[model samples]
Target: MRHVDELADRARALLTPGSRRVLGIAGPPGAGKSTLAAAVVDALGGQAALVLMDGFHLADAELRRLGRADRKGAPDTFDAYGYGALLARLRAPRHGETVYAPSFERELEQPLAGALPVPPDVPLVVTEGNYLLLDEEPWSSAVRPLLDEVWWVAVDDTVRVERLVARHVRFGRTEAEARAWVLRSDEANARRAAPGRDRADVVVDLDSGRVTPSAAPA
Candidate 1:
């Protein structure tokens, strides 16, 4: 996606030293997670770089070996511990340091190592994914200590499904496959994600681009 002019300004206003702020963008499978994250970074214009949770997807072979291929994108399917560790590093960045992070390959359906680099200079690191606000073990334990703030992007169920279908189609899934995937897999993920909205520091309504602030979930 192209740069987001608005998010850039917001990111700039939030930057500072002492703590590397991580803005967690959590939503259902096809809620434009990557697009919004990219737009936020593009808005930052080099002031920030992304550390996507997708990069931690278990390798396809690992998933198959674990017999969890059918649950890909589920909260349990990722290396949640590893993702949390990386965020910890980003928060207390050491000068002159460079860290390598993983990236997921959609066509290959696998995760590649050393795909993202977080130099010490970037003050803000925007990490987007489906489970940032999940309050369960391992996954729940991973992010809270690392984030300065968390923003939940809220899109209507109908539009989100449409967006997911379009995305799967763009990625070469058949119409039938896309719709089925959205209904079965993504919708399940969405349900799991719903409880997180109450935990957000800021909730964004993508349909209207309106933001409502709320106290962090108890």
Candidate 2:
């Protein structure tokens, strides 16, 4: 098991003078990708910034218009191409340009545009989401190349599902409704994303509290 500080130090190692690095955290639903990404970014302070892939989530109106509101977190519900473009810009920013990225408003279930301003000088841009390592047409072919490294977060499935249910309840689903959605929607999405773990540079096992990618540091 490894402490998050150890992970923070590893993230810090990616930083270098006059270059931008993007760290990606990818995992199944409720695997704590956001928490880890935020912690690492926080640990780095001014040297890093956070730009979430959830920010590319299709607006509720747009999702409903596209008839995909029922599967909100599924890969297709996001602007995959746009997210790739944003990452590419973060990877190679124009001089002195402060790039603005979108943010997701969970309570409102919508994405807010131009919500995060990432400066060109920030050495690390830490982004987290489920689909970063997804080897689909747009995500794998387009998005994967933009990231310097992607870590797959692994957790006890029972704990992960419980977190998903509780989160759904807290966000307005009834207890029964929450469990149903977690099992039906989140689980399905997890299956779709699980294969991407093979594409990750490392695996962060929260159950063991260790960074245990096949070739990761011991």
lDDT of each: 0.81, 0.89
TM-score of each: 0.92, 0.95
Identify the leading candidate in terms of lDDT.
2
Question: Please, what are the lDDT tens digits per residue for candidate 1 over residues 1-218?
Answer: 33256656666767876657787887777777788888788767777888889899988788899998887888888999999999998888898998887888877778889998988888889999889989898877777667777778877888888988987898899999989988988788889878888888877777777777777653
Residue-wise lDDT of candidate 2 within 77-123, one digit each (tens)?
99999998999888987888999999988788789999999997899
Off by more than 4 A, model 2: 215-218
lDDT value for model 1: 0.81
Clashing residue pairs in candidate 1 are none
**Clashing residue pairs for model 2:** none
